[model samples]
Target: HMTNLAESMEADLKVHQKPSPVIVRDALGIFLSILFWSNHRPVQLDNLTEQIKTLEMKPLNLEERLEYVLKRGNTFLGFRQLNELVLEQRKLIAKR
Candidate 1:
């Protein structure tokens, strides 16, 4: 599943290119943390949606977003389908 998430992230970064590749690579460190040390708590999708909005409004850089996600420990819950999560989040954002 982590591989799936990583692949999805790779594809996303390739398409968006908003954050530089270096930033994306750094962000993957957070994912690695999630992969290795997470407590496996299910992250509520609603909470993640709100966090996404907050991060977008603040225009936080990737490092800040990484810290925020690490602090919240949301993605730690074995996210088996990150692609779906991303797509759902995009739809939620588009609604606004």
Candidate 2:
């Protein structure tokens, strides 16, 4: 499912230069669903958080960053922390 989503998003990017918002939303929704199902497993949650932290080091566009937060941020971060991260990203984008 994640592979298919990535392929679809890549195809959309090839044609539109950016992923459609619907695709981003769907991807985030899928991530959230997986997170929900894995919540009972502490090891899985830690692995996912580590994955997110590693990905966070890569340079991503605003939409990708937003998707990252929506999809993975809540897994390890409180609402306030996530909100702060989003706001900080928005400010950075606005500066550009």
By lDDT, the best candidate is 2
State every prediction's TM-score relative to the real structure: 0.24, 0.39
Candidate 2 clashes between residue pairs 3 or more apart in a chain or in different chains: none
User: Which 10 consecutive residues of model 1 have the lowest summed lDDT?
Assistant: 73-82
Q: Mind sharing the TM-score for model 1?
A: 0.24
Candidate 1 lDDT over 1-96, as tens digits, reads: 445545654555567533334434444454433422232333333555444343432222434443554443223231223323334334544555
For candidate 2, the per-residue lDDT at 9 reads: 64
RMSD of 1: 14.1
Error of 1 at 11 (Å): 15
Segments in model 2 whose C-alpha atoms lie over 4 Å from true places: 41-96
In terms of TM-score, the best-performing candidate is: 2
TM accuracy, model 2: 0.39
- In model 1, the runs with Cα more than 4 Å from the true position are 1-18, 39-96
Supply every candidate's count of residue pairs whose N, Cα or C atoms clash at under 3 angstroms: 0, 0
